[model samples]
Target: MLEAQSRHGRTVLTTLCVLALLACNRPPEIQHDAVFGPSHGAVGDTLWFSARALDPDGDSVGVRVAWGADDTSGWTGFDVPGKLESLSYVWHDDGYRIVTAQARDIRGALSNWSLGRGVSIGVAPVRPEPPIGPGYVQLDREYAFRAVSRDTSGHERRLRYVFDWGRGKLDTAAVSYPSGDTVIHRHTWRTPGTYEVRVKAITDRVGIPSAWSEPRRVLVDSALGSLIWQYVLGAEVHSSPALDEERGLLYVGCDDFRLYAVTTAGGPVWQFVTSGRVRTTPAVAPDGAVVFGSDDETLYCVGPDGLLRWRHGLADKPGPAPALGPGGAVAIGDESGRIHVRAPDAGEWRSYRTGGRVRCGPAFGADGTVYAGSDDRLLYALTPACSLLWSYPATGRIRGSPAIGAGGTVHFGCDDGAFYAVAPDGGFRWRYKAGGDINCSPAIGADGTVYVGSDDRWFYALDSSGRVRWRFKSDGRIKSSPALGDNGEILFGADGGSFCVLNGWGDLMWDYDAGNDIQTGPVVGSDSTVYLAGTDGRLHALRTGCRLATDAPWPMYRHDARRSARAGGPH
Candidate 1:
């Protein structure tokens, strides 16, 4: 019974082996399905193929991929039973192609090919070129500029061009590509200087459509060679220099107890000895006479030739720069707390007293009113007849001249670190807190921006509404009043002995080093020259790139009797 059972088991085993051999003898079956993603694509688009294959005989299967047009990644290694695969191809040329796949079993048996999705390629877009434009502009005047760029891509797109004016100003414009490569732009420079102008092209699809072309230098206003001439004096100069356009002479006072007349070429024209140091800026009269006060308790009037025309003794030392009013009337103040007015034709004068020393000079209004500040912490408004019209009290002593605004407002700074803008009727309009002592007069721009410097070492620009527009820091205290250039540059000096020029937006354009502290203000001549006095007793001359005014001149501390601090004309 055991033998019979063994034989039957052997028979069964043989039968199973025969069946297994028969299956192995049969060729492995291969079946695969594949699909290409993004059925349609551009010339540069990458296409993806996903494929699945099976071996009916339970043998390993491999995938062979073929991208039509000879684009193929060949066969993949075999796996057990079935295979899942993915392939990618980028269309380099513009055309249509079909992706297909086949499968092979471990027995080297091949199957029919399975078709994949079709893909199409189109032409790609081309990048545009750099922009081209002109490279020259005049200071303070607008110039028409044009820039050109083009797109090479056959497809239409929008292109943008950016113009870097190189003076803290920029502009952007967009146009239709292919047809639009040229654009017209206009700009005005507020200061005279050299700057580089360039443009870049861009598109929504491509970043920086083209590289920025080489920059072209634009020359502003002055073409004078870069030469700064200085005239050395015997003592420190705390006075602003006066310019004589007719003879190209500069008049300034020195702590050496003398007033000097210097040629614009930095040559000494002459000197007039005073009893004491002169700390006041010389005021030029309509008749070409220069008037200034000295700590010697006297005010000296000198002719354009540096000859002393007259001298008036004051009751106390005069610290304020003299002002010339309409009809040649001269107004000044002294430590005695008195504001003195002299008749245009004679030395006869009248005085108005304040509670504190009068170290600040008086400014005239368009309506014939006089505005002055006092150490007594008050700002006084007086009629041309010397009668007090009104007085506005401040928290600190006022040591600077009052500036009249176009709207009849009076602006001044005080020792209390405050700047006040009062109405013409002596009513408070607004007050701005400063970082430190506010002892400098404010200058008004044509656009109603106010400029003043502080002992805090900052120069501030305030709008007509009393809001700070911008502030620039200096190395030291800035007691010097800010002067406006014809082209909108702000000029001032610092106790650090540096003189700086700032644009209308409070950007520093340039600066010069003076050997000593500069407590004096700066002035722009009609010929666009700059005049500055240094505590080192030297007067420096520089180019301002402004046009000279033949109609009037900067005759006093704040330029005009109005003390608006606005130079040139109504602007």
Candidate 2:
């Protein structure tokens, strides 16, 4: 009887030990209704669901998720107790789905399932419509483009857009818009070429991207200058162009507040932006640096690579184009009536105050003398050191730059409606009266013939003594200066958009209608091509079959094709 009692006691002791061990360990506890996810998602879209759980014994926990009745994910990697755990799932079919999650401790003790979450899965959004914009565009000018998309699943969703500008440029919208809404974007092209603009859409909730829209072809033109090719700029061009023969590039400024460097092929090479209108003609230095001034009261020097080499601040807006001097020095005049000269090597600058605003570009004599025309109706001469030499008075404002003749005579025009010749020593030589204001600079021929245009609508050829040899009538006022061709022909533009060429005998060789006001003068290229800027915002290149006059003194507006404003002849 004692042996039987011992056996029963052992069984009782084993049962009590098992109950104590079960009481010591606890299963993980999931928070009530803690499952979270988007309420709506597209079919085949990856959706994420999360849940939070806690282990009563401070053990790590892992989460297991179930979608509807058929799909269930294995437990995820363990996370700290009381932390949220997430899993991603893709539903192939559209339906109202219920998602729930459960948690388990490292010891494999599982928790009860959290409250279920419902999601309405549907089809993805449709591809966006192709972008709509101008088929042709001018370089560096911004234009508006638009696109639209819709959710084919009939769901109300916010959509985001992405744009490909075709030139390896891509942009994504920062904010999403409601589905089927037209999205507008602004873009600018810096280089000249053909581009394909395209767009795509993405749904904000489903995070699924739609297919890219059909591409829209856009032909971007440089618009900076053409018969071979024409480039269009952002605004009208009043500034003349300077050619770099070695690089086959042309530099010009525009009222659009930018300096553009374009290839002879009429393609954009690069651009330098300024804060103000760039009305001053660019001057090319011997070392390939381009110098110009802006109405922002500053002068900029850019290198051949379209990078800024340096810039100088001025007290007032520059009134005229910059002039390149010996050893890379530059000279420019300002509305404040100051002539600033910057030394090439030292980068140091010196200024000389004038009696009035200098509206005409300064010219350099063979002897290193600087001559500038001012609104004060005086032509002032100075040395390279900025020291005053002499001043010749005029009846009206001296608006045109001066041209130095082979005989050391200075020729220029005045608002007095007369073209004057001044001796090198500041003495008056003679003046030939015109019908209206003389605002255009003079160009000298090898045989000592002086050519200039007047606001009176006539271009005149004068002998060395200021005697009118002959005159040619134009369709409109002649404000554009004359450039000489290698064949002894004079080429200039008039206000009526007429680009005319005349032989030395004052006979019209030919004329081309530019379809706009030709305010800027023509510059002859080495290959005899002519470049002219107009108020129409195009640089027109004409194959004139005549080269620049190499032997003539002051052949073009600024003395040479480079617009260096230096006398003697082409460098």
Candidate 3:
């Protein structure tokens, strides 16, 4: 009985030993080079890596991936042994990094790490520099902006740019450019307001975006008329004002026998005294010279500093403002029925005698051909050399200056109460008769709409074909020419000191009573300020919050704020 009991105990001990051996866990095993992932990546990139492992006891296993010493993915969900497990990790820094992986079984036993995979993490492009562009722009005008950036990854990569136009608008380039290259983009603002523009760069391949650049603030004006300030001169300002945009100065002739140079801000800069009434509008040359005709029977040229540069004597008192042509040529008409023209860099004055006094400023065609009106009832086209090109006879004397429109059509009003459109080659396009003499020059709009004023006290808007579109009645006879605002608003003055603003549909926007007749038309500045000359002896600067319609061929009297009298150029 003792021997049998001893054998049973040995058997039980042996069974217990076998059960303990079975319960002991063996850690999951991974191949020495089983970890795999991309060899290169950019910062902030989410990279995937796969690792395979096997458990000796056929237990489920989980994988853990470490992108760096500080970045790690905690254990993943358990899966079957010998399965390839994929885990994702993001690197915040740039440089060479080693990725590693390990495995664990359900029994909580960890295995040795697999061979590390070498990944060369790249850096994204640097933030772009602040956009470079104009500080002030007219509303609805397209402007250009530039952005630049560089990549520090030491790799030849392309970068794309994105622009934020501050108006909750964003634009991305259609294609990428080389790193450190400048990217140009254009944007237009429809509304008037201050806007901040910003930009950013991104790697084209990895799509890693850099920080945004510093913002550039831009001011946009509506350019519609509101009173900013008014400067009263010594006498009536029948002469239109000229703007020297580069110097921020305005030059205008006053009946007080003085040529005034005022700042655009309404402060008096300087005034040049004349011997006779200075009734002609001033013209600015590219070299910062101001030229105008005075009843003193002299055409004077003054420097930007208000000093007289030179003066040329005329046959008789100059009746209208001088027109500046290409290369500093000056053309003016005198009461002696002579049109005097001086060539650039020449000392001699060339003259062409008309049958009657030349009372209006001459307009220039694209090729430098000059168009002038005479009291003899003729519209004469002359060459820059003062030789007649062609003459279109009118029923009565032509008093107003002529305006050139698209396709070289010349528009002018007649003392016989008729408005005519003459073709470029001296052929008549059409004629529209008014109830009274049409004495104001025509302003051509972008769509070929012609705006003019008549002695009948009416402001007329006609289509390109000389058909009346609409007409607005004024308090007195209309004589002042029309100027166009950027938003298609028309501005004109009349005999009763009335300056009115009208929209494209002929509805009145507003009006200002200058207390005296406004014979000269209004001039618009880049900031949309309107400079109106009134017989009240004041130059009114109205902040219309509207810009000039640069697209219009003839937006104002004598062409532009400088009274250039040249066609096919910027307003």
RMSD for each model, in Å, please? 15.8, 23.7, 12.9
> Regarding TM-score, does 1 or 2 come out ahead?
1
Cα-based RMSD of candidate 2: 23.7
Range of the 10 consecutive residues with the lowest summed lDDT in candidate 3? 1-10
Ranking by lDDT: 3, 2, 1
Per-residue lDDT tens digits for candidate 1, residues 1-571, read 1122254455355656666666674444334355546655545566677677777777777776787887678777777655557777776765567778777877777777775667655443332233233233345656555566655445444566777787767787654344354565667778877887777666534432455666767777543313378778897777778766666777888888998888888888888898898888777776678899998999899898778888888879896688777666777889998888775567478888888898887777766677888889999887666779999999999987888776788888899799999998989899999989987787777677888899999999898889999999998899888777654567788997788776556666566777678887776666566777878887777765644222323322475422223233231
Ranking by TM-score: 1, 3, 2
Candidate maximizing TM-score:
1
lDDT of each: 0.71, 0.84, 0.84
TM-score of each: 0.63, 0.60, 0.62
Error of 1 at 418 (Å): 0.3
- For model 3, residues 151-182, the per-residue Cα lDDT tens digits are 87777579989999997899998899998887
Residue 515 error for model 1, in Å?
2.2
Deviation in angstroms for 169 in model 1? 16
Q: Which stretches of candidate 3 lie over 4 Å from their true place?
A: 1-224
Residue-level lDDT tens digits of model 2 in 296-352: 999998999999998999989996688877766678899999988876564678888
- Tell me the lDDT of model 1 at 475: 87
